[model samples]
Target: MRHLAIDVGTHRFIARLEEEAAPRTCAAFLEMLPFSNQAIHSRWSGEAVWVPLGDFQTGLDYENHTSHPSRGDVLLHPGGLSETEILFAYGSSRFASKVGQLAGNHFLTVVEGADKLMDMGRTVLWKGAQWIRFTDLGER
Candidate 1:
């Protein structure tokens, strides 16, 4: 049994495995979206408001914006998952990256303010299990 913590930021995604005690970097995860150029916006039709892309009924509502087919029982798509799983995994990866970047930036900002403190070191620090390396489909 292993616990995995996925911290998503605006620029990158950080994955930390509780059992391994490591952190991994994933950049360009969001760019792999199938509809990257497609923007979802609120549209005013002749009579009604139209929501672009519509609402997703099934699967986890990732980032509260997109949805994909569920991948069995695993919420986090592990390696060797099904095709749907892979898709969701990549989606999750991208979301993670966005979140990581945002968090990392926030953390950096806070750390910068705490420069006078000696105990607080660098802006980025991973204190957990080992890191499990995984290839991002975005890069593929």
Candidate 2:
């Protein structure tokens, strides 16, 4: 199982790669490690935050996709009906956009620091966009 260190705003978390369930998406995502972007509270997807990539290509289709994601489930939207983006579910979430409902590749799942998910969501929701970074936690 591969792990990733996610630091968003002032909060930190650890997530496990869902390689078995979403191999292609996981592989592509891993190739882009040490990634940083701005995350804003979702206007359509409830209790979640997203980093809109806007046409960023992953060269892959949906794998292990879902519209409803539990808290701490991280999804990658492979750009089609809507723009490419990363969804971080902090609580109940039904992934969607201005265009309508959509599903995304469930590539990562937070394993540690989940207790702070709601706080992270609230912070982004009230305080506005926050900087989010993803780092590969190699060989551990």
Candidate 3:
């Protein structure tokens, strides 16, 4: 399994890449490691935050798509018909967008710092969009 880190403020979360489950998505995502973006709290998906990936050409691998994602699961929605974004589940979560509740491509699963998931969510939720960075832990 591949590894990555999600860093927000003082919190650091290690994530396991779902290469076997979502190979294509994992490959594309790993290629863009050390990605920094805003972790915005979703108004639609309860207790979830999303990182918009903008128009990346990552092909769809919906094998891991799910509307309801477990807390601490990191997901990517390879936007085709809609915009692409990364979902981070804090509490109960359902990956959704303006269109409606849609499945998100499961890519990263928090392996460490699981307890900090809720705190990260609450930070982004109450304080507004937070700058979160994804780093390839493999380099370290």
Candidate 4:
């Protein structure tokens, strides 16, 4: 299985890449390893933090997509109805954009630090945008 080490502000987490379910998305994402960006509380998606990737493209369409993701679910929005983005759900989430409801490719799922997701979300919500990074852990 493939794994990724995620750093959300002061918190850390390990997430499993859902390669089997989202092969193209995973491949495209892995190519962008060691990704870093600012994550802020989502204005449309509840209980989630997102890193906006304006006009970014994965060169792929949605795979294993979902608008409602459980806690710890990581989604990549294929730019179309809205700008591209990566969303991390710490609680209930209904993915959307200014246009309306949308779905994202569920490429990563947090396995470690699941309990801290809420705290991470809260920090981004109240303290403003937080620096987040995704480090490829390779397959293990």
Each candidate structure's TM-score, on Cα atoms with residue i matched to residue i, is: 0.15, 0.98, 0.92, 0.98
Q: Write the per-residue lDDT of candidate 3 for residues 1-140, one digit (tens) a residue.
A: 67898897668999988888888888888878779988889889998888877787677757678889999888888887568888889889877778888888888889899998888888888889888899887732
Instruction: State the local distance difference test value for candidate 4.
Output: 0.94
Q: How close is candidate 3 to the true structure, as a TM-score?
A: 0.92
Q: Which stretches of candidate 4 lie over 4 Å from their true place?
A: none
lDDT of each: 0.19, 0.95, 0.84, 0.94
| Models sorted by TM-score, best on top | 2, 4, 3, 1
Model 2 has an lDDT value of: 0.95
The per-residue C-alpha lDDT of model 1 at residue 54 equals: 27
Q: For candidate 4, lDDT tens digit of each residue in 44-138?
A: 99999999999987787879999999999999998888899999999999999889998999999999999999999999999999999999988
Tell me the deviation in Å of residue 62 in model 2: 0.8
Error of 3 at 75 (Å): 0.9
Cα RMSD to native, each candidate? 17.0, 0.7, 1.7, 0.7
Q: Between candidates 1 and 3, which one is better according to lDDT?
A: 3
Worst 10 residues of 4 by lDDT: 54-63
Q: Where is model 3 more than 4 Å wrong at Cα?
A: none
